[model samples]
Target: MFTQFVQQFGVTTCGTMVWGWHGRTLSSGVHHPQYGDCWLRLLAAPKAKAGGKLWDGPRLAAERFDGRVHKAQMYASVPHVLDDFAYLAELSRAITEPVCSEEPVLREEPALPDRWWASLQTDLDTVAHGTSDRVAVRQEWINRVVPQFLNVEPPQIRHWAVAHGDLHPANLTAGTPYLLDWEGFGLAPVGYDQALLTAYSCLVPGFVKKVRDIFPVLQNEDGRAALLVVIADLLQSASRGDHPELAPALHELARTAI
Candidate 1:
């Protein structure tokens, strides 16, 4: 797939391959003859479930949100099949800054200036205002997972808004707070993005406190509900053997929050 696209798109893969969770995605830094440096993510899934809003997320996001808060998307490709599997690719301007943390789930808080925090708040507010019909988090899914994973009475969701959908440490950049991986952005419970970050930062008490302090919504009923929902979702993921190390922390956080 890499060789085929490099030749077809006239791009040279300059960086080592970075595989995403479960090998679902393969990303590499590429240099294009005309476009210069770029980042390419090749997404793969079973052919039966290969294409959807996620396939075009970066392209669509580029149309609505500018590069100030996210990487500027350059191009997207139609599905390319390989027997029972299908593949698609998205290209965006390479972000020169390092990720906010070395990993997706923060093992420890990274050094971030107050100005960066302020910019993150501003950018997240902007993200919530983004319009999209996609449903990133569904009430039905929340209803089912919250009780199952959180073991608490699910809090009612009174508000809904667009969110970055995925805002973990890896998806965020350090210096100025650019959100990556727009594939999950859409309408979710209010403060979904904020709560998601908080859940992921559960192991870091200082970072969790700071995030809760910065986002007042975390103190409200709706935002609290959002936090539980995100916790439930992550716990579900952990149950499936994805980051099981987070299971204990997430469960502890859910207990305290509830």
Candidate 2:
């Protein structure tokens, strides 16, 4: 059944004959003696297309097969981020809790409501010292704006469903747009996805307005400030890599942070 579908949708991928190992969302190139190996991540369509072709959609980390560490982290983290946001959005609507408010939508989670903002602070602290100083600065900015603009007092965030800790286009894929990578996913901060998306909008135009319309709570400065925090976080993330394609945007985000 899978092979038939691949025949139809999978793009013709060319590389030296190498071993293939499949995982949840990625396939690794078997280490080979010659013609350095590469990875081919298959993105099968939800439904098969013409001629029962299986679309071997895109290959992630094609050039370098050595850094299994970074590749695995990204693969897991990206989907986890998407799932968290999607889950939180659904829970917020089901309970009719203002998606934009920093309050718990699921009152049943009592312990959660009490420590929402505190949890955020802890995460911020982790990033400040662990990720980069810029991340810490951005988190500080977010803390200031929350009380002043969003009117969120001592407990600015409400207990809610888990959130996709980090969300951005690079971490996501349209074929499997909603994969689950749980490492950074957690609960805290309202409109977190919108903030991340808005920050990404600076790189891809029209993204900001589109995300804002879908997430109405992001219309003001408070929401935008929250978005800046995520953007700063992403900048720190991008800086850790040597991918030239990511450097320019990271540099731009750094400038925007100031």
Candidate 3:
């Protein structure tokens, strides 16, 4: 079905995922006929019934803060009811730059541009009060996840803002630094995104420090509380056998945060 769809646009499939119904890559001819160098990505759309926000976050970022997000070309619907949607978007390639590592890293830093940080802050501000189609962050979810793993009580949240809920090194590109994967973007605690990045970089002291230096919110009370929320979420994911290699590092971070 996807192959036939690509054929309609006269674009060839350059790559496909080995497993999962998540992704496909198409030749750049779909976007440009002459200097067709850009790649197109076919990504799995989030399910509405599953509390997916459908492209609300990315669309807002693209329209309001252009450079912060990759642009989308179109979307298609599948016949099936459950797994029924996909979106085609322009895939960004770093210009002589390093892509973010998918695996957890303890060292090896990538240079992130100052403009990218500015874009992130601007993006967060633009979407801070925007309506979300995904599940809103709740104190109950935090309560359920936190106390089960940590002895400390969940921290009170005094500030709220829209966040790239899955913010981490993997979801971010270095150098130019465009944030990817908006399926989980929604209203979260103000510092939640930075907290997740910090947790992911916890294995690298220098990188963690870099994150702290970039986002000074992590040094405050609300930021510390938000980091606990991220740690709680990570612990929940770890319990399900995801990122088992980072289990030790996650545990250490959780202890310190708590």
Candidate 4:
């Protein structure tokens, strides 16, 4: 079916494995067996069309097994998607060079629907300030930790660029390091991404440190606190179902948060 859809497009492969999770793909090169090294990807349509303009790489068009039209973006290597703090630091410095006519990598928040912010609030309130079950801890965190560190109001989250919303190693790729799966993308403080990467890094070593270093805006303590909130929310929502694999990770996250 894919062959028929991409018949004249010189498609190289179909369903070739690439790094991804949820509904988005990171990188999947379709190598034309007869066309030598010709290859490309079939990226799904981004949740936010405006976000696509911020994408930094080659682009293509793709269709799903169900005949849904999708944009296919190409990348030379997905490994570049991995968060390498050292490399990012250099890139940051290069981009900050004054008088450079090149396209400035705009690090700004994307417009989001109002309801999305409300949904995140449930977790933010539970984690940042705790619920009725542990008001003292929430108070302590707010008075002693959250304010001194995070430095942002719970309702207003415009201090940082748009976060991937759902960030994990699975969303990354080695061929073209594109941050796929924008369904959860939204505006938040810098610590949100750091916290997420830190929590997930417990299962995969070194991811936390690199994410922190690359995005130096996050304080270690604040990042952990923010992460605790996110984990708690994720545990309560996505992992709350009967998925055995996530049950334990969810419990652990909930316990740690409270």
Candidate 5:
């Protein structure tokens, strides 16, 4: 199916295969006769589960945003039904730089330069301050989950800002930084991205402090609310065996924040 998929693009794979969660998506680098290099991602899911706002995120991002930061440029996307499943194939300009980390949690502190940090601070601010009616996290969902996950009523989100939705270490590039995986980008609580990055970096206290210093909003009511929301979400994921190693640290952070 992938060979057939690439045949439509007139390209050939050049790099190692990368798989998304549960092998639902497959991504790799491709070399084109005219386009040189590009990224190809194919998402396979049941027909009923494939078409939605999140499914269209990369295309929407390409149409709506550019120059806000370094990111992939979508050249083409084709969605079609294959047997009982729906497949969405997206072709984008390849990012030559490696990601900061291969997974959400960083095993060690990243030795990034001042400009890299500056770019992240500036880019996140730019995106968060933009106006968007789309949503990354809903109030009703937060209200329902926070109590179950953290045993506390959700904080009223006083500030709602556009966000990347998922901004863990793996989604960001090293050296020259670029944000990846736009599938969850939309309106979320103010400082949601910063809070998420900090929450996932619980093992690295020094890096967490640096993030706190860079974004002083983490100390404000709105940022605190966002942090609580992110921690609650992480706790929920921990319960489900996702990043179970962070469970203890997350509980400790929850105590500090609460």
Candidate 6:
């Protein structure tokens, strides 16, 4: 199926998904004369599990944010034998360099424009209030993850907004600074994205300081609460043996925040 799909796009060679989690992705130099390069993602539609919805975030972002987001050029869907569905979305290749390398452990900060930050805040607000149906980031979810992973009670949330739920260095591009991976994008605690980026930058002291200096949210109470939530989420991922190297750092960070 994968090979056939590539053929439809006339792509001769396609690399494996650079970061495959909830879906599969591939990067390829397009064979078509009209297009140069592209990225493709195949995602499984939401199931009948706890949080099920038909909203396609990447598609929505492509439409709403347009030039600011990685462009979604084309997409198609296929029905599964069961009561589920799958989709293939092709996006325009990012022209700018990513803020950090694919493995963000040793990445250095990239120069970004002030306008990028301004646009990010505006876009996040638009998405959070945009007409879409998805699960809101409830206090219960944070409460559950915090105690289970960080072994501490959850903090109170003072604000909420639409966030790029998986905000980290790896998912951001510099120069122009376009955010990637909208699969997890949704309404979340205010400053959640900033907190997540700070958590991931714990290894790089300079970068951490830069992030803190740029985003004033890090100094406020609500921002601190959001950081605690991000730490708990990271700790939970660490417990599953994901990003083991960052576990200790995340633990210490969580301690300081708590």
Best by TM-score: 5
The candidate with the higher lDDT, 1 or 2, is: 1
Q: Candidate 6: lDDT of 96?
A: 43
Model 1, stretches more than 4 Å misplaced?
A: 82-84
Ranking by TM-score: 5, 1, 6, 3, 4, 2
Give the winner by TM-score: 4 or 5.
5
lDDT of 2 by residue, 15-111 (tens): 3332222322333232222322323333322232311111211112111211221122222101112221210000000011122212111111112
Q: What lDDT score belongs to each candidate, Candidate 1 first?
A: 0.83, 0.34, 0.61, 0.35, 0.87, 0.65
User: When superposed on Cα atoms, how far off is each prediction in RMSD?
Assistant: 2.0, 18.5, 4.6, 17.2, 1.3, 4.0
- Write down the worst ten-residue block by lDDT for model 6: 73-82
lDDT of each residue in 155-214, candidate 1, tens digit only: 778889988888898888887777878887789999999999998888889999999889
Against the true structure, candidate 4 reaches a TM-score of 0.40
Which candidate should be chosen as best, given lDDT against the real structure? 5
Model 4 over residues 83-112: C-alpha lDDT tens digits? 321100000000111210111111222233
Model 5's alpha-carbon lDDT is: 0.87
Candidate 1 pairs with clashing backbones: none
74-165: candidate 6 lDDT, tens digit per residue: 43322222356444545455344545557545456656677776766565555556544444467998979988878888897877777777
Candidate 6 regions exceeding 4 Å error are: 7-19, 44-55, 68-87, 91-99, 104-131
Any idea how many clashes model 1 has? 0
Cα lDDT tens digits for candidate 5, 1-258: 677779999999999989988898998999878878999999888998987767888887777666666678888899889889999999998988888788998778888888998999988988887776678998998998889888887888877988988999999999678989898889999989999999999899988888898899888888888988999899889889899899788878777677
Residue runs of model 2 more than 4 Å from their true location after superposition: 1-161, 171-177, 238-258
> Which ten contiguous residues of candidate 4 have the minimum total lDDT?
86-95
Runs in model 5 lying further than 4 Å from the true structure: none
TM-score of model 5 relative to the true fold?
0.96
